[model samples]
Target: MYPTEESDPFCLSAASATRLLTDAPWRRFASMGDSLAAGTGDPSPGYANLGWPDRLAGTLRRVRPDLAYLNAAKIGATTAKTLANQVGPVLEFGPDLIHISCGANDIWRPDPDLAEIGWNLRRIFERAAETGAQLTTFTLGSAFVVPGFPDWHDRVRALNDITRELAATHAAVLVDMWSHPVNSRPNLLSADRVHFSTSGQAVMASELVKGLVDVLRAHPVTSDRAPE
Candidate 1:
């Protein structure tokens, strides 16, 4: 019963019912977001083979290696694009857990309607929550260094704040990557000053792992994190 302004039921439409309600331990989790998530431009095999979600899965797999997961990230994506790519697959997967990192590209575009980004993310989370799936979101690294887009740094900060605030509202775990070695560590990025090199992506994967660990701790349904 998600509260909504719509006059009638705030619940999903009947057409969406099958996709909305899920029974889980969502071992078949799905990952969503942008290039950083896709590890785009990562000039190393490590990121290509093992991005953050994969790293998170591996650490958890240390106990339950067979756990099923999927990454639906795309290069150069924003929240709007993320919704496009993520909504259908997410509904189809009905994943027990979901991790999202987007909105940086949106900031790059300098859209006047910042609310649209927030609304879109909330929609994604609200829809997924219908199935009682656990959710996690990432505050991506800085946008200033994204090469061609210089005006985006402040916008990215705005987007990150919105995402973190929403996470608190919806009880979702959050990964904050806009600062620290990800932002400060020169070795973590490519010469383009925007995309990550392999090692840099690995660092991202580590942060992502921490967020997933937090989510798993909260949900505690999977066997990997059983009383140990």
Candidate 2:
């Protein structure tokens, strides 16, 4: 069902990764995971545009237009589901940078395991390493707290722990979205209270991009010597 693409389901970064092999500065960057990164149901004027990745990509292009950015995020995707499907696309694209924001669905499940989340992450990290992409990830905020989710705060915490440990192991730059205090407020949520409205997505996108900028700046890419 999911074939590789010119406009197919899985947009591989292989050509971009290869272009990097030729010393192109823009031959880098890929994002994969769930809705937060996808900016699912982003509200812009009427819940239309302005997802985090779009905003993040805008900022990135402004700062470094050379970057080859690809976002493969799906709404309602768990970390496991992301790996199951999205990983194939990353393998194809093989860009030099990767961003991950996932695991929100697990919050709704009765019990979730951080280590299993870690396992899913390892699969992603290993794949990135294979392609020489520097991976980055974000801990999803507490979506459950919106209305029906009396347990959201706690579930998000548990998941963030797993995500952090996974990042450490994979050497990913961590974006801790859960730690944001605004999540405690109801305005950050849509009428469903689970998803962010367009304005909310903009805020979250700004938050995530800040972390990404910090990391990219702190550890500026220096190896001009393209890998063989």
Candidate 3:
């Protein structure tokens, strides 16, 4: 069954999500990078068209009605591209919270330069962190498969490793979806089979909310390191 908030126990209800983020301190939120950041996906039958970032912003706004948000993600953007283009605008936005999604396009072709991709991703993390913003990112889900790429799984695994390493190094909140149970659902992918469907996006948003709630618990607002 599609994970609609109305019926699916797995999906967070509107009030539940709001309650989870009631103490969130972020006012300006910016999302940058590739298609995943853009929330590129097919719409599920019962879900909203909003992508994960938009869905997250909505919840944040519920907590703080004056939330400001910018989603500067482009489809097919590589890590290098995101660093070159998106970073400046995000910095200009002065976001208190930032979400990054990149490197998926970089590994789409054979013989991806994992080293270079990792370098660009590290820079992206560094720049976002420099803004004093709490950073959030997601590992590519295992279900995001591309046919005719013999080493596709290996490539994704390697990229995810880099993402995890950088997220740890930068203290970014990471949603490690590489082997999430949601990926096992039959309706997880869109028609392209590369991006997630709205069902998956909903799951991403739900997980992110949960992750942030945990972060808040560990580092309450009184702490200097608390997410603001």
- Best-matching candidate per lDDT: 3
Ranking by lDDT: 3, 2, 1
lDDT tens per residue, model 3, 145-180: 688887888998999999999889888899999988
Query: Between prediction 1 and prediction 3, which has the larger lDDT?
Result: 3
For TM-score, candidate 1 versus 3, the one ahead is 3
TM-score of 1: 0.73
lDDT of 1 by residue, 6-31 (tens): 22221122223212222124466677
Best by TM-score: 3
What is the lDDT of every predicted structure here?
0.62, 0.64, 0.89
lDDT of 2 by residue, 1-228 (tens): 212223321122324323223322335567788877676753434232566667656655544556667778888888789989998887787677777778777667766776777678677677776776666777776544634667767777777887788788777777676756646544557667677666556566555555555565666656464354
**Model 1 residue 129 distance off true place after TM-score fit, in angstroms:** 2.2
Give the higher-lDDT candidate: 2 or 3.
Answer: 3
Which residue runs of candidate 1 sit more than 4 Å off their true CA positions? 1-26, 44-49, 110-112, 143-150, 215-228
RMSD after CA superposition, every candidate: 13.3, 9.9, 3.1
